[model samples]
Structure formats: C-alpha cells, structure tokens
Target: MPFSLSIIAEAWPTFEAGLITTAIFCSVASVLGLVLAVPIALAQFSRSWPWRVSAKVLVEIVRDTPFLVQVFVIYFVFPATGIPMSSTVAGILALTIHGAVYFSESIRGAILSVPKGQVDAARAAGMSYPLTMRRIVFPQMMGYVLPPIGNQIVGLIKDSAVLSIISVPELSMAFQNVLGTTFAAPEAFVAVAVLYWLLTSAVTLVMSRLEQLTPTHRSTQEMTSLLAKADR
Candidate 1:
C-alpha cells in the first residue's frame, strides 16, 4: 500500500509531453467545434424543411451516440473508405465533430428561447435573416447561451482524454505507458487526474470572467426600441 510521487518524477518528460499534447488537442478541437457549430445551429432554424431536418438529424446522431464509438469509427473503421489518416488526425476529427454537435444544440436552444415577437418585428421591418439574427436574436441569446457553452467547453477539455483510445499519445496514453513500465498505477493516474482538474478549472475560471465582462441585457431593449421606431 505504499505510494510515491517519485514514479512521476522519474518519467517527467513523457508526462510533460502528454500534457502539452492534451492542451493543444483540447484547444484546437474546441475552437473548431465552436466555429462549425454556429452555422449548423442556425441551419436548424432554417426556413427550408430539408435543411432544418438534416441539421437536426446530424445534431441528434452525434449527441445520442457515445464518444468512444465515434472515435473508434473515425480512427479504425474510417480508413476502410480508402482515405487513411494518422491516429492524431482521426482523433482530432472525432473530437471536433462530437463537440460541434453538442455546441450546436446549446446554440439552437438559446436561439429558440428568444421571444417570438422580436423575430416577427425584425421580419416585419424587412430585416434580412442574417441581420435580424445579429441585431435582434444574438443580443438576448448571448446571456442564455454563455453558461451552457462554458459547460460544453469544459466537457471538450475533459473528453480529450478519449483521444488516447485511438492511441493519439494524449495525457492518458502517456500515463498508461508509465503504468506499463513502472507498475505505479496510483501515482501515474493521480498525476493525470490532477492535470485534468487543473485544465478544466482554468476553463471555468476564464468563462466566469467572460460572463462578468458581458454587458447587461440593455442591448436587447435597445434593439426592441429600434424596431418600434422603425415600425412607425
């Protein structure tokens, strides 16, 4: 029942490399997810039934399936289609697509929560779809979406551990190697757990700060007033 941090010290280089990989993987994949998600979320509200249905199906399929399966399919099965990818590329694709769907749903929910009258007002005033979204919907929706989006970002960081399943050499895989050579599972696992906690904590901290920096909902009211004036 003996425990020692010396095991971690012994393989510090491997652990450090893994930590760096995890950081880059998480940040890049999360940003890619968010960027792709916004458009897909908007598509869910599309006037065309086909676009709306297709977007909804994509979102649901990704959300419903387990991430482990998604990664396995991307890494192992996908190459059968004749396009081979490195483990890293496959892992990144899985993370991006999976996270994007979740982010899209968060966005779609926030968009739906906006008052119907605001949307109508924008339409009646001859505002284009994109402009209405910008001037009317987004202003109010930002507050509602921020909290969930923050949660999703945290999920993205933690889920990067799954990248190890595909042998992408992430933090978890690095520690698994440590466990193999040292037989010190306790210390290796503890180190990775602490590192993940630190990364996620930083995400929550930054998100909270951003939420505070967000202006009050005065913009929504201003948008309403502008719509009212235009109607006259």
Candidate 2:
C-alpha cells in the first residue's frame, strides 16, 4: 500500500505512550547525570591520586566504549551476577552513567576555563574550597557549560532510542511495533522523526534561554574586581 497518514493516526496511541516514556526516563536520567557528574568532575581536582585516577578511569571507559555495549552489559549480563533489574530501570541506569561521564568532562572543562587567579584570590582571602567554588567558580562556569550540556541533553534523547533493543517502550520501539503491525515503513518513520525533532528542538530552545539568563563574563569580572578591592 502507498504511504498514508491514516496509518500514523492509527498508531498515535502507541507513539504517544512511547514518547511519554522516553520523556520521563530521559528527564530523570539527565538530572541524575548532572548531579552525579559534579562530584566526579570535582574529584579530578582532588589532591588524592586514587580519587583522581578513579574518576578519570570512569570517564575514559564510558567515553571510549560504545553506548550499545554498555546497555547490553547492564541489561543482559548483570542478571547473571544477581543484579536483576527491569528494562526500564536498566535503561535509566545506563543513560544516567553514560550522561554522567560525558557531562562530567564538560563540567571539568568549564571549571578549567574559569581563570585560576580568581581561585587563588579566593584562597588568599580565607575562602574555603567549597566557598570558592560556589561564589567564584560556579557562576562563571555556567556560561561556558550550558551549550555543551544542551548538546548532551539532545544526544541523551537520541540515545534513548537504543534502549528499544531491550524492549524499553520508547519512540523507536513504538515505531517498530507500528511497523510490525502495519508495515508502513515510510509513514511510521516519518512520524517518529518529526516527534524526535520536536523533542530535541524544545530542549535546545530551553537551553538557549538558560544561556541568556546565566551571568555573563562581565558580571563575573565585576564580582572578582570587588573581591580584589576587598582583599586590598
């Protein structure tokens, strides 16, 4: 049969369910990734060699290996070690760990981009490390980090499709189910593609808005200038 919107309409429920599932799980995973990444990123600066080395190893392994293999190991292999998890949970865990390593690197780079002098001044002025990071480093780092974080969020959503291999009812799996039933390859795929585009575009727009709202270099400079005068 020729391509038809009717086939897509008939499959809209499955597509909608899959889209919702994708949105929910990916949102959880992304937030967790950012939270976990901060500690891992900071660990790279730790004076302890073991902490630094371990964090570096985690980042290298995840960044170097294929994500598909990671998912397979989590879903298929872990059960044999008595770590059984539902596919949804497994998918979330995989995405969380994957995004965390990449996001940590982005955060680490952003932290490095903030001039070391500011940190030194913070230390000289009796500021503790946490205080320095909070007042001196984090505000400035946001401006540099948001763009890459946005890219990672988009990549995370796309990567969620891979979870369909484990029967995690996501958009790609929705497409598969619909295609299996109706065999409307063109129509099913076109609809899924449009949905994915819309989802990623919305994330990009939000990130852009956040980038605008975040403090600029001038503001950070002013803060540092005031701090310097106080130290004098």
> Which digits, one per residue and each the tens of the lDDT, describe model 1 over residues 55-109?
9888878888889998888877878888898988988898899889988888989
Model 1 misses residue 150 by how many Å?
1.6
In model 2, which runs have C-alpha deviations exceeding 4 angstroms? 219-232
Best by TM-score: 2
**Structural similarity to truth (TM-score) of each candidate:** 0.89, 0.92
Error of 2 at 56 (Å): 0.4
Q: List the residue pairs that clash in candidate 2.
A: none
Candidate 1 local lDDT, residue 34 = 88
Candidate achieving the largest lDDT = 2
Candidate 1 global lDDT: 0.86
- Candidate 2 achieves a global lDDT of 0.93
10 residues in a row with least lDDT, candidate 1: 213-222
Q: For residues 1-232, could you state the per-residue lDDT of candidate 2 as single tens digits? A: 6878988998999999999999998899999999999999999999999999999999999989899999998988889899888998899999999999989999999999898998999999999999999999999899889999999999999999999998999999999999899988999989999999989999999999999999776446768898999999
